[model samples]
Target: MNARRGPAWTNSITSTVRRVLAPLAGSGRGIFGTAALLLLLIASGYIGWAKWGDIIVRRPQYVLTADCIEITPQPPWIHSDIKSAVMRDGSLAELSVLDPDLTKRVVQAFELNPWVAEALSAVKRAGKTAPRVTVQLRYREPVIMVRTRDPRWKGDCFWPVDTEGVFLPPEEFSSTQTKAFLRVEAGNSLPAGAVGTSYGDAGVTGAALVAAALKPVWSSMGLEWIIVRQELPNDVGQPMEPTYILLPAGAPVDAVAARRSGRLVSLADPPADEPSLEVRWGHAPGREAPGEASAAEKVARLHQYVAANGRLDQLPPTTVVDLRPGAAGTAVATGRPAQTR
Candidate 1:
């Protein structure tokens, strides 16, 4: 009787356990099915995107044309030609295809151009049917014209150089652009025609500095030209040094005279054949010789002398004003009658 009672009790325990597990098994199956469906959907989307990605990139709605590009500080010359080149250079392949890396390449291409000093940015507008590509460009501005002797040319050739001594293409310049700048003669013998290249020569660089420094006073002072001549070594072991000369525009040397009283006398109507006064600007700005004043100091001294006296032409002709530091005084205007005052 006790064994029969134990079997009945075991059967009752098994039935209770089955009833508790049935619902849990069904829930597990449902969860597994949901996970499989999610994975399938993800795989299908990826496959579709991979197959149709190029199609989306090539869509007409996303294509960029010349009209879509914008340049800042609009250059004096036509920009449509440059826009065409940009488009041809794969800059406007497709809005979708232009990743960050490709966009950088496009910007570099524009920067490398001779016309552009800097390519600040290239951006594509998002969510637009006709996508626009905005390009920020800094154009190369010519500060001074350099007249150098090129072996390839029979005569002296002129090159438009920026303040950093970078050569710009002469063909790109219009007459108005060419005539507006002052000319620097550095006796640079380097070959020309390679636009966007710099001589990196010290003399050329110094000349550029002088030109930049004088720009403010150039027109005001009636200055016409700057001549940079490299002097021979003083001693056998010494290096060569540069000398700067400032020539007046249309004013002749003999037109202004130093009277016996040491006062400046300007001729009422000077002859056109008379030579212009030449100011001896000791050296270029940054390349001052040892024991010499800086270009800024020299310029200041020259201005002080001019203001104390009068216009540059008011000084005597053939006058050599030594502006170097420690030079006898602020300026020693030699080759002229001594000032009484």
Candidate 2:
């Protein structure tokens, strides 16, 4: 009976120790998990703060100024004009402020340049300390040069004009540059500073149209220049007439006499010693004036005639080509036989 009691006592001691040890182990595991989760959240927040500080809070490296503005692909002659236009407002501070609206204004200033046909954009260059502005410009091309009287100048001088008859400033061109373009005599004049403006003058517009039509075959035709004349009516209440004439580089005396006697009326005071052929292009082409041929039709007819008959010089000296819309709306060439020398 004593031995049985001793075994029961030992069993009771073992059960008490197991119950106490199990609860202590579970509490230790829960505390460790909670501490690890808090540490992970703290590390994530520190990384996010560092990135935000670098992008938004740092000082910018560059500023806007006249020296920072760059215009490209424009000839040296026009550089002064471009610079003058940019600094006209006298506010470098306004340009330096980096903003979308300010960028748009800068682009507009460049576009207003008389020589610039288009201002593509004004944008900031990447990786610059102070942002530099780059401007892309498309310059206007001169199609024809005209000599007109300007009150600002001493006498009549030549100026370049585009296809739309917009006058370009002559101040920037050298004599060699001026002489390279085909000469056109508009027989009209415009006011001072007409560089950025266009004249809707019928004679000027008509001359431009004729020049464009002749461009493709101009070299082959041995043509030198074009003349636009406004003819007065012989009697009252008659509509004025516009005449188009083509002149060779150097015409002989006989050719001049022959042209004077042709079907087309001669200028009362024709430029002395100059000979020319009359195309009888009555009005500006593409204008769709009644009883007139379209520009394309006239060009096509001229091309076909030249292809069949050779250049204009090969034709009789007195020949007058009529490109107007006739009864059948076809071009016709008429003149007396070539005179024997």
Candidate 3:
């Protein structure tokens, strides 16, 4: 029968042991030789454990606590501590750094935050002093504030929503912060749904798209509200269809300066005497009438007009500047004072 071969290192150790103990056994000290050999093995094991046992053994120090999870910095609009919120809400206050699925669990936890549109990735950064997991995420930003005619919402109050009409936390914005966003007046609609959910109103959704498109130049255009009108009172013989109107601020104040200085041109303030200026934005993008100009074309035309007239409000008040294909920039006098609400 062939002798079973052990590892080379083990065989070498066995040979060394036999050579060292052979003298004691031959000297009639066999019991002492065995005891000394056992002591040597135990001492070697203790030294080995002291040198490298931490790497082999798991401990609480090696685990990931909530404080060890780092999130990428969020935008100014994000007021809540996303890391704390996610960890507490997800019940992931403690996680094992050695867990094979650590990164996956981290991603899932961050996704639980309503403001987090997507948790892109989580990477475990193994630091000698302390380990940490860094997470990259995409956040949903509020594009516009929508005001429905719902009686439940008091006085000029609005709900902030993203481009897709996803409602954002209202308390996140102070009264001063709200002035930074454009407003959409979705007349005759209900209140917005729960926070972080879609507002679920078609008019509000369409109005949101228009608001987003107008956001860049809204103040420059001296605009205050994007009104979603189902029908125009002036269109007596025409069929009723959804249309958008850009209502410029009543006063001829410096729109750009007002916005930059954090001042709002109050609709009911001293500008009460001036007639309202309305840019008749015919339809929201992609829903234009067959013969009407495309949204891009309309915006270009409006910009051209603004370039020449200084701003949309440069036109006489009580005037409606049509931006559709056929009636482009033809101002119609409404012959009425601006309504203050």
* TM agreement with the true structure for every prediction: 0.67, 0.61, 0.66
- RMSD per candidate (Å) reads 14.9, 17.3, 12.5
Q: How far out, in Å, is residue 218 in model 2?
A: 2.2
Ranking by TM-score: 1, 3, 2
Tens-digit lDDT track of model 2 for 121-174: 877775345667777877766666676656787855777776777677777677
Model 1 spans with C-alpha error above 4 angstroms: 1-46, 75-100, 148-156, 174-176, 188-193, 231-243, 250-276, 308-316, 326-329, 335-341
Better of 1 and 3 by lDDT: 3
lDDT for model 3 comes to: 0.69
The TM-score that candidate 3 achieves is 0.66
The stretch of ten residues in a row with the least summed lDDT in candidate 1 is: 256-265
Residue 319, model 3: Cα distance from true site in angstroms: 1.8
The lDDT of each candidate is 0.61, 0.61, 0.69
Global Cα lDDT for candidate 2: 0.61
* Cα lDDT tens digits for candidate 3, 81-141: 8888887888775666776788899899888677988899999887765678989999988
| Residue pairs whose backbone atoms clash in candidate 2 | 61-129, 62-129, 62-130, 63-130
After TM-score superposition, what is the CA distance of residue 74 in candidate 1 from its true location, in Å? 3.0
Candidate 3 Cα outliers beyond 4 Å, as residue runs: 1-59, 149-154, 231-241, 251-275, 326-341
